[model samples]
Target: MRKRNVFYSLFFFLHLLQQASSDVHSISGYFLGSQGLNLPDYMERITVDDVGMYYYDSTMNAEVPCPEWLNTTEGQEHWKDINLISLDNRHRFASSLQSAILQFNLTGSSSNVNVYQGVGRCSLYPDGTLKAVLTHAFNGEDFLSFDIDTKTFIASVPQAVIYKRQREENPVFLEHLTFFYKKTCFERLKILLQHAPAVNMKKVPEVRLFKRTKAGSKVLTCHVTGFYPRDVQVEWVGAGLQSVEEEMVDVLPNGDGTYQTRRSVIRPEENPEEHKYSCVVHHSSVAGNVTKTWEEHSGLAAWIWISLICFFLAIAGTGLLFRRLCKTKDVGI
Candidate 1:
């Protein structure tokens, strides 16, 4: 029984290893110098590093040859124009769509020789990602390589999920949701906006502070007036150029070539006097940059001082009127 159990375990492990190896594919190639010094090959894998990968072949180190044909003065000038020293001797082939041959032109040399040749094919993943691969024959040996530019599709493969309800045709829904009746259009609008991409509120409709509260908090709003897709963000800062807490409310656009947005932050609570606040806007149309801050000032203390001066003047005038009435009565007596 022990021997049978060990055999079954080994079989399961081998199956898993086979699946992993089958899932992997790679593209690689090496460069060789004129004197036959071979450099490192460029290599990339599909299962590892899902994002597209690239590398420059640089393994050759043999000295460049001064050919006998280019020994004259005119030949020397021609050699200067051709950067033969830094030239890539190997033809680099890129994979592509459809069954076809991969080709690259040899640079710097006048021979116009086709460096590398291969048969290639490309395919697209279900999630809109693309991959291309190629194979070539050299010196009676077969070589294979694959393109690593299908990152977006590879990353989109969904993670496996488990569901409690198995059957697709029969779904469990609350058997008629009852005791709910209200005429709220805004609720439906909110639901639609939830699935919509978040706006980069920091940008758009020129950030401006249009109003202030009695206690000394500035009201800021922005308009994203460009013809680009709507993506924006907003924030507030204090006089010291630091981020401050704020309460925000969403104001919808009127669909008349305008969008409305506003937010407010408590400023006077921190100073109660002459202090400043800034409105910052961020948006994607502006390359996801933030505003430098639209400024606002608080003058609550100044308004208090003006009210006190007016009250004192009214009291002095009342006392003067009483004195004048007494003087008039004494003169009549």
Candidate 2:
């Protein structure tokens, strides 16, 4: 599965490269959500720049072209003065049909908000002046006509064609770093947890297990969060503090400044009296071992009950034997 995903990503990037120099109007594609819904609402504009910037609502991310140097102090100050004064009117310039389509997507209405999770694409018109024919999956099965002047849809196309635009200069290493630093990591993480609480950072495993209540068998799930490097391991320990063997799953990176991992298994759902279990997180940097125990209720309770029962049994047996010996002695006399 890992290899397959890598292959698909490479293929998609190559396909985007080939589509760069063609002269066709419009392309159409679809996105399938987690539930396989062809949700148009989550569909934002498809951008084809090497920068691959997406515009969801009316406001465009004007910082796309800002170099990573602006990630520092002086660069930001310079950009504030230059960008606002000089380029305020046109951060998005449309010299071709593709550029026009891009600008239109960026200039959406207030009510337009969508979060897409699948695949989508568009074809552009090849005319040097301004002509793009493309298809959008969420809108309909038909290709939509893209206008260069107004940056809106005018008509639909019957077939997919090659739409080409002039290639801009490739971004330098600093540009790529800035792109990820600004676009992918932070912004995407915020989008993923759009429904979550403001303080809830989305990708941490945050594994959690409920209190064990029964006696025969029990399974607990714990949440883990903020794990980096994408590789992590989880283990369960018994009352004797011995490790138990169980199946494990591969951890996947969220790419948005967070990682997610999970561990689940069946064990003695320790009784309220003598239950004990521990969840340990294993990683290289952790000194010795990193573990959190949930014995506040189970392990301590069991130990206390066992100790009390043993004490009473010992006392009663000793008293009964002594009484029997005394009675025998008196009878003999």
Candidate 3:
């Protein structure tokens, strides 16, 4: 019985392992190098499964050859040491390489210093699970991870490497490394800010109110366009109060490289005028939340105004005809 129980436990453990492995479909590593205001920056990306390697010149937006060392026998042997057979292992090696490149580009004693950045990413299929680790030479030895599922960021290194590195007792060397890491981190942040999307709040979203004829309900839609940096918040405010539930659509890309999103609210059997409905938008580009109120105009109300105007015109026309006939009769007599 004990042996049977152990067998069952082992099977369950293996099943969990298989499940975890199936969750991740592909892994990739990326590196980018840039000098201040320099054209033809260097970029390289490698994926484990599809598109094994890529090298490009950023300024010209053209493909380029891999580094000379990578083509050598020693380089090939070093690549084999990274064990690129397994996707997960490939990403690990790629991350280490990224870190090495970043350090070399950013920390080296060169007259024309350049910034290097590297990223290791694992992507899961169907479930849209993404795990990404980013390393910058400026940060010293630390790396940051982002989990798409939880929307959280974590900063750290592998436990085994941390233990090994901590055992080294050279104070001066350690201090120098620390200083270089801090400097690298600063430069990386500066480069990121320089490339960040610019904010423009000149064009506000348009809000429209539409009534459903059969359901006797009103729908308020907020249409926002011509926005950058994809991350935008849209909300619905009802009668000066917060809406309990609001439905929002995903942000879509435009032809011009901008982004747009929409939010909508449905109020049933309620007079649109009696209860105010406002669409509020929040974006990094804007100083504050932009709010637009809904103006109600029903088809029945429009037709009623048109009929009243036509009736008044018809009455005036009949009065003029009667006065003209009276003058004619007087002249004939």
Candidate 4:
């Protein structure tokens, strides 16, 4: 059963790789909320063509100067009001918000395009009160909570109002953002993806297997290098032919634009010889999956084997030489 599961996993991984390779465009965006001692809870930046198009600095309570292409008169005017609102409510609450997020994302393919936008705000007050709100623009969902029994509004309304007004005024803000991003960003990305110089390209992976001793235990590692697209799946199959737990390190970039990743599994010490391991790598560049089996030949073992072989050969040669000399002596006598 475990063997069957391993094969099924390999098959699914290969199918995923094929589908990923056929994809032409890739797009991703992130909205992160962090707590800082000296910084604001909310911040955002948008990039296009590898250039920053728009930035909002919550600490400064202002929108930084954008790229010329995005600095249209209308955009400037719109942000002016938004910035004013941000500044007005910058210090209204006694306690700062723990975290807040406002993010938008767009991804496109030949057949479909996906867009997502969301906002979330959470604040803790000095009077042991908490307030939070989360909104998803794509599905028109809003979640809010507060722990206060007073008439005073503990949270700011300007940011929420501005977002709501923007959505109302421009029903397709996500679509427009996607369109603008494609016009300014996707073109360059496409060119980079298609025309990556041959000198900077790697078509096949170089795989290596080795063992390391750490904390008196043996660790087996599969090192894969010189692969393109930066998305590769690696698995370790133990003696039972089941996928073993492995720790995969982050993928690091090579000087020539290829990528490298490492996966490792801890080898059990007891009956280590009875346990065999194999590393399987799946990449789009390779037609089929690559598998490498582990060998138990340690450096010391290899040296001992070579030394024994040489010693036996030396003894046999010496005996033959002595016999030849004795034959010569007998003939002379």
lDDT agreement with native, every candidate: 0.32, 0.38, 0.44, 0.46
* lDDT per residue (tens digit) for residues 223-332 in model 4: 99988766688888886432225454766656454667888887877777666688999988888888988856554476666566556666778667555543442220
Top-scoring candidate (lDDT): 4
> For model 4, what is the alpha-carbon lDDT of residue 85?
35
Worst 10 residues of 3 by lDDT: 13-22
**What is candidate 1's lDDT per residue for 177-269, written digit by digit as tens?**
010001111222222223223211122456545444433544443332432233345666665432234444543333432345566554444
Query: Model 1 scores what on Cα lDDT?
Result: 0.32
Which is better, 1 or 4, measured by lDDT?
Answer: 4
**Candidate 1, run of 10 with poorest lDDT:** 174-183
Model 2: lDDT equals 0.38
Q: How does candidate 3 fare on TM-score?
A: 0.35
TM-score of 1: 0.24
Each candidate structure's TM-score, on Cα atoms with residue i matched to residue i, is 0.24, 0.32, 0.35, 0.39
Candidate 4 residue pairs that clash: none
Instruction: Kindly report which residue stretches of model 4 are placed more than 4 angstroms away from their true locations once superposed.
Output: 1-24, 27-179, 187-202, 240-248, 298-301, 305-333
Question: Could you tally the backbone clashes for each prediction?
Answer: 18, 42, 2, 0
Q: How many clashing pairs in candidate 3?
A: 2
Model 3 ranges with Cα > 4 A deviation:
1-186, 195-217, 229-231, 240-252, 255-257, 287-289, 298-333
For TM-score, candidate 1 versus 2, the one ahead is 2
Clash pairs, candidate 3, are 138-184, 138-185
Task: Compose the digit string of candidate 2's lDDT tens values, residues 1-333.
Answer: 533443454334223322322123222222221112232222222322111222232234454344442354544453353334223213221122233234336335433322212232333344433222322321222333333333333333322232212221323532543443333333332332232232122122454554432335455555465654344578877654322246355454343444556665555534524655677786534545567666546545666665665566666876765555434422210
